[model samples]
Target: MRFLNFPFLVYENILKHLEPRELLLFSFCSLKTRTLVSRMRHTPTYTIFILDKPEKMSYGFVEKPEKEQILLSWTWKKIAMESENLDNRTRLKLKDVLLDCRVTFHRKLNIPTLVCRCEDVSSRKRFATALHSHMCEVFHVKPEMQFKLSLDYMDELPYTNTVRDVTFLQSSVNSTVADEFFEKFHVTRALFSKRCVPDRLLKHSCKFLEIKNLFVDWSPWLDITLLLKVKCENIMFSSSTSVANDAHLIMDNFNLEAWDPEVDKIEYDEPVHDYCEELLYFLYDIKKYMLRSGILRRQSDGSRALDKTGSYCSS
Candidate 1:
């Protein structure tokens, strides 16, 4: 059967019925076939968002971009959701996969976070490289695949020319693992959970990073000023009561020593509960600043507009 000669509408219907993997395979048959596939309204519709974990390889397909997320998991045993950790998205017990090494949300293009169970470094490298090559060929895409590695398994990283983005999730096992992973693969971002992110890793991770976005959660007492040395475009912190005390809304703005954040690209959600007079002063000042900055501008409906310069405030 000459699939190339099929009527465009017929091809569309057939393509629509194909599974995500089959669609990917069909897209790369020939030049004419590729063009026909690309012209079918949704060119790169079905994409694998997260495809990791060793024995229990977790993979998924996306029919709709953001709202509709369908997860397809493969395991030696049936999977089940057993518990929850509401305070932290990262801390959420995503199944009982314990041997999994690294969990990173690569900031390069916001790649899907991987929960990998590949323990041996050599096995991890081979599996990751094979999968990366296969996916890139199937999707007709460049090598922008992202993988997260820690100091423990740093020696296992493959030296292939795959455009790899590695993010080191600061772990409690040992915070000083940057030395093991940073020199090998391209380590881009670091997600901080607690206060024990060793001084060396924090200091070294940013020194050679090409791109950085710092994510801090439940680390209210984290020294905001230390970030000054770290070159980053954006910093995100989730305010929550931790061991140190109340979330002080730490940011580059905190170092500015002003009641207001004084920067356009800042995001602040109203504190879960008020901390003290200092917190009140901080919020009031930012509110006044936001109003004064955008009160003159009007939305399509003539309401005062904000976020012109990246100041996103939620009550």
Candidate 2:
């Protein structure tokens, strides 16, 4: 009678109540239970990278820097994965957790494509380079197969002789932090000739390569220009800041007289209101508040804002 089948939910509840070690043993009770209960939990995909701060290098030690610059702080933020099927609620939670943790760069940084929440230059570079290497070794996703790659932030290092199109999710045109990035990543037309980037990044790419956040400077006209650039055809640059009215902007901007009007109209009629508007707004707003306070400033105007309508403001 003890072996009679229990309701799936009842068995699942039993498994949940067990300890980790006990749960493993509990699974062996029935093959049906094993499969059902095992798959119930959400195991978030986490890419463990090396902790960068000089102190973190010493394994368990913490180092104090010569200057107390909060911007210099680093951490190991979560990188979005192609395989993870995280729901929107879970994704937002992950972003929150990552903002509080220190950003860590992976040891061997050149994964063809990376999706990280890290905002630091050294940390971002390290994560990309190390991820590239890891992908090559583990998943066999080599640079040769990397026809498109998007970095949340661009590092100053040269490509590993195999990458094609590089995209950065930059948040500003000029900031003290931007200087550190420019110093590291060169963006002469010779290196990354064409880019999957916005116009602001294009200007910086003339001298340095960095990606701009869509929310930081959202514009429908700009998005169309970026879409037509050919370099960014397959790029995903929509961020929350531009979600409100950017789609209309994209449609209006891309709707040309030369191309078939009906086809253009069809494309324009696509349903992306929520995808482009609310989600992006949520993503960008949370990120802006969590990362650092205050927007990058412009020396000429001395304004303290990050919107397209105003000049940059320093903290």
Candidate 3:
């Protein structure tokens, strides 16, 4: 009997037992199948992530049960499969575009991944974008997408709405490129960078901000002032050296009265230093000021400002 000939209950039961990848492939069978799969109650919501270097899209849950969290990955590379079974290979159509895909296990992630070998880079980008749109519609989930890419692939930047968080993986980014990127995409959620970010980029507001090994452009005071202008709920700053000095600078400039009320946590890390008395005093001073100004309600639990031995956390 044809698969669609089955009753609705039987169809749902079969879908419930199928893996995420299999269900995804089944959705491509026809419009009827796609709607059925999409309306099913057992469908999983995923956080979609896109990378440009190898040109891949990965989707997974953010929570625990790490084994089953990462359901599937799609890439344009021609990866060799562990099993040579011909059944693992198939061709799927995404709207007008047809893709040749093979089921394979990711060596490092230990998750099922689909590999599609496109003719060239342009075709790969089109396929990835089309598939991403298809998944978003079929899954009926809010666009919670993250993009990790190097500056070299700036020409291939995706639509602005599809990118909520951005991580620049380039070793170094010039001011011009950084200015162009910020001008193009206004990332609203989080911004992460390992390289030095220009002051203009730092002025943009986000929900979360994290920078590693950040060097002061002019001085620590100027850097702190720029960071203060960013309206974020949570902030983390780390440096390999001069961390203590940075902490002091932050304490001096971080005015709780002027801080965004939405902000709840602030953390700073320096690998080389322990909890110094001066740092503790600065933290206490901030806490006392917050208490006197009625900015902080809880006075007894002030230890959270300098919570760790080597790091500072204020909540």
Number of the predicted model whose TM-score against the real structure is largest: 3
Over all chains combined, what TM-score does candidate 3 have?
0.58
Name the candidate that leads on lDDT: 3
Model 1: lDDT of residue 182 = 45
What are the per-residue Cα lDDT tens digits for candidate 2 across 142-176?
Answer: 23312111232234232344322222332444334
Name the lDDT of candidate 2: 0.31
Question: 101-126 in candidate 3: lDDT tens per residue?
Answer: 77678778567676776445655456
What lDDT is obtained when candidate 3 is compared to the true structure?
A: 0.51
Q: Per-prediction RMSD in angstroms?
A: 13.9, 18.2, 9.3
lDDT of 1: 0.38
Residue-wise lDDT of candidate 1 within 187-294, one digit each (tens)? 343322223344445453433323344444334333423333344433434333231221243321222122234543334332212112233344356556443223
- Candidates' TM-scores? 0.44, 0.25, 0.58
Off by over 4 Å in 1: 1-11, 19-54, 59-127, 148-172, 188-211, 238-315
Looking at model 3, which ten-residue stretch has the lowest summed lDDT? Answer: 212-221
Clashing pairs in 1: none
RMSD of 3: 9.3
